[model samples]
Structures are given as C-alpha cells and as structure tokens.
Target chain A: MKRAELIFQSIALITLAVAFILFWNFGKGVSFAENGLPSGPTVTDSYVVLQENLNRMIPILLGSILLSVAIAFYLEEYLARTGWKYQIIARQIIILASIPSLLYGLLGLYFFVFQSKKGSFFIHALTVVLLVMPRTIQSTQMAIRSVDISIREAAFALGAKRWRVIIDHVFPHAFSVIMSGIFTVISRALAIAALIIVVYVWTKHTLQSGDTFYIPGSAIVLLLSSLLSSVLSSFLEAKTNWD
Target chain B: MQSQKTDPILHIHDLNVWYGKSQILKNLTFDVLPRQVTAFIGPSNSGKTTLVRCLNRLNDLNVNFRYTGKILYKDENLYAPQLKAAKIAQQIGMVFQKPIPFRKSIYENVAYSARLRGIKQSDQLDTIVEESLRKAQLWDEVYKHLHTSSDALSNGQQQRLCIARALAGDPEILIFDEPCEQLDAAETPKLEAIVQNLKSHYTLIFVTNKRRQAARVSDVAGFLYNGELVEFGQTEQIFTNPIDKRTENYVTGRL
Candidate 1:
C-alpha cells in the first residue's frame, strides 16, 4: 500500500490494458476500407481457427489445473499432520517442487507421449499437469502452514470436528494464501505452455498452427492473474484492525 | 456463579501427561465446579498450558502428547478411547493468552461457531452473534462495525472478539489460558473485567502466572510447582493459610 508500490502497480496495469486493447484492435482492424466499404484478402485470418483451438484445448488445460488443486488439498492435509512417515513424503514433495519445469516437460514428453504413444492434445495436457502439480502442492503446503495454530486449537476446543475445524477456521484463514499460490502456479503453468508451444505445435502435425496468437493472450492472462493474486494476498495480510 | 464447594462437573483423577519422553503434568488431580472461576497459578514450566489443553483434549493434536488416568465430565470419562476431542469441546470452550480473531468481519467471527452447530436461520444467527458479543462486553464497541474485518480492533478488543466467538457456541465451560499475558498494562484491566463478568454464566478456568490476578478473580485457586499440584483450596485460604511447604513458598514469594 506504499505510494511507490501503488504507482508501480498502476503503471504495470495500464501497460497490460493497452496491450489488451492492441490485441483486440488487431482482431478487428484487418480490413482496408474505402468509402466505408472494406475489401481485402481475409485469407490471413486465423481467428476462427484460434477460437477452435481454444475451445478444444482450454477445457483440457483447465481440467488438469483443477486436478492439481484437488490433489493439493489432500497433499496439504498430509503435510499438516505430524509423523516421520508423513515427513518423508513432505520432503519428497519439496524435492519435486524444487526441480525445474523444463525437466518435467521433457519427462512428460517421454512418459505420456513417446512411451505411451498417446494423442498430442492429451499428451500436452498431461505434460502441463505434471509441470504444475508439484508447484501447486508446494504452495498448498505453505498456505496451510501459514494459518495460525491458535485459531485451529480454538475451534477444536469448541467441539468442532477435524474437517469442521479446517473448513470453518483453518481454510478461511488460509484462503488468501492458498489462492495466491494457486494463481501463481497457474500462471507458471500457462507460461510453461507458452514455452513448450513450439514443440507442442510441431508434434500436433499442424503447419496451420494458430498458437502464435495464443501466446500474447496467455502472457496478458498470466501477468494479470499473478498481479491480481498478489494484491489479494497482500490486502488480506495488511488487514490488522476494523474498529 | 456456583459455590466453590459444589459437586464437580469435571473431575481430574491423578492425570499424567508426557510429551514424548519428557513429562509435562505429573499426577495432577482437580475438579472444576459449574459456573465458578477456578484459577491455576504457577511459575514457568509448571504445565499450566498442558493442563488446560487436557480438559478439551486439545493436547491430543500434539502427536508427541501422551497422557494417562481419567478425566470425568458429568460421570462420563473424557479420556475414554471412544471420546473424541471435538466432541469433548462441545462442552468446553477456550480463550488463549494471545488474541486470535480470524480474518473476518465482527459478526462473522462470532457467528462462525453457530453456523458450524447447524443453525441455518440468518435471523437466529444474528441474534446469537449479538447476544454473545453483548455478553463479552463488546457489542457496544462493535455493533456499528459488524461487517468490518476484526483486524481493525485493538488488541484488547480482538481478545474480546475471541471471547464472543467462543460464547456463540454456548459451551458449558470457558477456559482462559493466561488471557492477559500478551496484553499491555492499559489493556489488561479491560480483559480482566470481561473475565470477571463471564463467570456468572459459564464455568471459568484460568491459568495465570500473575499472583494478584489469581487472588482477585478466582473463587478457588490451585498452585502448581514443577509439574505437580501443590495445593488447591479457597483463594483466600490458599493465599492466607496454605497447607504444603511448596505452596507456602510459592504464595509467600519465598521460592
């Protein structure tokens, strides 16, 4: 909430908005108009193809991302519990999260595509899932850890069951933390898609690739989401009093 | 508040607790009477925290925490295997030494427990929130800001908000684990006043390191030393005529 930070964020946001306007204008400004009658070879238009790819590809991408989040909830519970056995799994998750995403993309290509000979779209979605799941799990762990212990204890002492305590007390307190980390991981996952798009498009056997346009759209999406999430987490963190 | 000599609601029968290999509470026995404030006074490392946590089985959350003996709540053995901590907690609510209001609105903070208890009517929840806040002596300060995040309140107010949250559940007993320890001198009296007023409706148990606070607030006082209960009796008698040497030493400031 500092003035300098606020100014920086505002400037970044404005640049993003201008970038979005430029993309939208690109979609509509293709025709050369004379006497208000437009004429051109509209053969360069790939917007329909782009929409087709998005409609087909987006669902798989979102499904994998949601799967990661679902797994993260269970993983967070394991991380929160006490025991050396759980600690071993926690250490493994930490190690997996620390490994680079590029390596994961290669592993996905090997395991989900080359080894199994699956379709390109399915393999790509699988690859992205592998790339993002570890980071999501790591973020979920941190979110749960950040919740104050006293709040959970207070709920337990009120006769709230374990799930009740988590739903009512721990999860609400940790919601911002969870959302921020999940959003960051999603952005990173989208960025990974952008990074691997070259290989992804090549593998799909499509020279009429419309993904070139998807890159800029996703970049804007990534930037905005990460920014929004950071703002949300910081707002929750800064709240100290109401009266 | 009930008389200090009333039949016990919670009977602790030689309870012992250990954190892994290290012992925390050693052969502790006591009884908590209904609607009366029972204060536990002890120096550092005397297991005051561990003792209170045992009442609601909050200590069970600690994987290393292990205990023996029996705690009877209304002739039901609280330490029995079939008894879950969450179930025991329905009758025992706690306010910690530090204020821990959730990142929520004032009404939401108090209404949280009521919702968990399966009260779905908005009107009913509103009434419970108002009544709980009123009982905690915080409604007048917070009524106008019911929808605002509790973080805006001062430390004293935040602690009171916690009390209101606990009260919303209508638990039979309310435990104070050194509620004013984290508070400053200016905020202490406000918390003490709330604690004093709370004894009329709920069974109040206090764990404090402050000698004067124990004498001022408690109907009965128990002295703990080195993980053992040394003496327990009427607060006035415990202060004026302690039976054991360790109790005398602790109360008279000789140790």
Candidate 2:
C-alpha cells in the first residue's frame, strides 16, 4: 500500500480505539443493587402505552425521510440559480434552520395538528417533518455547491439550459453527497422524534406501537433502531460508491 | 503581415477589465480573423487568461470583477449588459488548462447539452455524441466504452473529452486557456494537432507560454506584458521581425 494510505489507516484505527475506550469506560454508568442487575420487564398498562408511542414514532420517521427528500430536491434544483429569488430562498432557509425543533413542533401543532384535529400520530409525524426539512435543505445545498463549477460551465457552453444543467450535470455529480446528507437528516430526525414524544406525551397519555409487540421501552428501542439503520445504511451506501 | 487588409471577425477595442478596485487588463485591443488560430502569449500574471475569459463574459462570474470595454463577436458587441452570459457562453465555449470532466459516462458528457436542447430520442443523441467525439478525435478510443465513467480515461483523453463536450454545443468560437500546461511533454504535440485541426471549423483563441508551440499552431499572435498588449501581428512577423523592442526581447528570451 502507499505510505499515505497506510498512515491514513493507522490514524483511523487509533481514533476508533480511542472512541471505544471512552464509550466503554466513561459513557455507560448505570448500577444495580441486590439482584446486581436492572429491574426486570414489567407487564403493566404502560407496555400498551409504549406500544402506542412506537406506532406513532414509526410514521414520524417515515414522514421525516419523505419531507427531507422533497426539501433536498427543491434546494438542489430550484433555489441554486443566480438571482434575487435564489438569495431570498437561501436566506429563508438559513432563518428556518436557525429555529429550534421544539419551535417547529409548536408551529406544526398550530398549523396541521391542531387545525386538523387528528390523532397524535399524525401531529407527531408532521412535527418531525417540519423539524427535519430545514436541515435537509441546507445539506442538499452544500452538496450541490460542492460540484465542480467547470463541469456546470462545460454543460452550459454545450447548450444546456438552467434546468438541464441541474438534472444532467449538477444532480449526478452531487448525488452521493446529497444522499449522504439525507441519511444524516433521517438519523437526526429519528432522535428528535423521541424528544418530541416526551414533550407532547402528556397530551396523548399513551404511546402507540403499530400492530406489533409492545413493551415499556419500545419508544426508546424504535428511536435507537431508526438511528442505527440510517447510520449503517449511509455507511454501506458510501462504501459502495467509494469503489 | 498580409498588408493588414483582411477584416477581422472578432475585435476587442480598448478593453479595460477590472476586479473591483484592482485593474487586471489595461486598454487591450486586438483582432482575430475568421478560420484562423490566434494565440495570446505572456508570462504568469500578465493577464493572458483574463483577456480570453473576458471574451466569453466568464470574467463576470466574480461579483467584483468588472470591465470597461466592448468585445465584438462577428461585429456584434458582447458586453451589452442585457446579453445573458449563458447565451454568450453557448456561442463561445471554453476549455480550461486542467481536464475537468463531469463525473459521468463519456456518452452522457457529450449528450448532456443535446438533451438540454430537448432532444430526447436515443438515436439522435447517439449520433450527436458520435459526431462530437469524432470531431474531437476521441471516438476510436471511447466508442466501445462510451458508457464508462469519464474520470476513468487518461488525462489526455479527459482533456479531449472536455473538448468534445465543448464541441457538442457547436459553438462558433472556441477559447482554450493553457490547455496543455498540465499534460506531459509526450502529450503536447497531440493536443497541438487537435487545436490545429479545430481551427479549420471554429475561430480558435488560445493562451500559451511555450513560444515554439505558439508558433506551431497560431496564425496570428498577440504578446501581452504587464496587463498591456505589447504587440499584435502575424505569428511569423512577431516571431521573426518584431517591431516593438519589448516584443523582440520577449521573443528572444531577453525579458
């Protein structure tokens, strides 16, 4: 292998080792007494409530992904051109991103959830969508910007109009980067959904795990699974493209 | 010098280009005739590349980069504020010193513009790609593997692919900015041949520092020094019997 490659590998391995050490020694810190373990699972009314939360969480995850993809497409294609509209759109995106996720949930509650008078599941999902949309827009914009200017110019000089340049040149060149950003937003939204549920949980009273096995920790498990899946999928996808 | 009798196809009159408060090109004036290769030669920081970019309005990409002058393409003024840079770019394509191929298949690179012009039929796109590659002298090597990624090609091939991408638009004028600077010595002459062959169909404007290579390819030559046009005339006259002292010094390596 090249010396540079070897050095990079060594650095990555060392960083991973350090991270593992920190996680094992400093991160996990729960202790148990008497039985020398945590409390065993309980069969109580809360199990059904957790199931309901899981059910509500699943749709929120899906909605976040769908919403992020839509926002990504718009930022990558429509808002990238040079004009007053581009500047205004970019500024609006920045302002939107700066708003906290809880604020977005509040806004969604006012707009979609409260007005529609639907179940908490739809409200939670819509809130998650609003929370994740701005991040996706920003990531997609960055990915599009990273495309080489020469490639875009070359396409335009050849006869490509504005839309053609984005679809044929900019989009293809930025596909991997944009997909990775989408994955990042999906993971982030999954984590945020758990927090949103905690905030709005008082109103719903019980969590809804969709037509599946229900447990007290289902909400936490669902959040963990979604986060894990997005991260793993992004890694595999990036690895496949790297070759 | 052919008695200076022929009417130039493209002319730059008193071109003064500035980047915000800093001036880059100073009162530049020159003319290029049709079906001829004109080379701009100068040392680094001499505004050779800037002058060529100004011709295509690419210099305007920088918000602060402004200019005071008129660039005439077929005697039509290009700097008319109302004219879109994209339209000007369609009329005059550019190839940079570095080979920049979009991370896509060779066929896609060639067909991108055709598709943009609303040609969706596969057969029409295939013909255009083939013709463009043939013009760029890249078809034989890339014919079978046109679907392969363009970055997989050799550096020289990638450079030719960029040229093919430029040609696919069928522009009237072509600008090359030190196109062979990144290539090895062995690849220089092949690039020169491509430039020479292209001059037959398009008005070619090139920027180069290699004196012999400039002499080998250009019909007319302009020497720029310190952001000013030092001399402009036929290639042979500028190389062999330059009138200006600065031009003579530049040609003889005395400067």
Which numbered prediction scores highest in DockQ against the true structure? Answer: 1
**What local distance difference test score does each model get?**
0.76, 0.75
lDDT of 2 by residue, A1-243 (tens): 699999998999999899857755553342222336434222222334446666766666666666665566675555534457765665566655655554554455444433465555556566665677777778877887798887766665555566767777787788898788877876666555444443344334333433322332453464455546655664565457543
Over A21-94, each residue of candidate 1 has an lDDT whose tens digit, in order, gives: 78666754554233353333231233443444456556776676567655666655534355566556655555
- Scanning candidate 1 chain B in windows of ten residues, the lowest lDDT window is B1-10
The superposed Cα distance between candidate 2 and the true structure at residue B200, in angstroms, equals 1.9
Per-model DockQ: 0.49, 0.31
- Which stretches in model 1 have alpha-carbon errors above 4 Å? A2-7, A13-57, A78-80, A109-122, A199-243, B1-5
Query: Against the true structure, whose TM-score is highest?
Result: 1
Estimate TM-scores for all models: 0.79, 0.72
For candidate 1, write residues B22-120 as lDDT tens digits.
998999888888878899999989999999998888987887888888889988998787877776786688998888887789998888888767888
Q: TM-score of the candidate numbered 1?
A: 0.79
On lDDT, the leading prediction is 1
**How far in Å is the alpha carbon of B172 misplaced in model 1?**
1.3
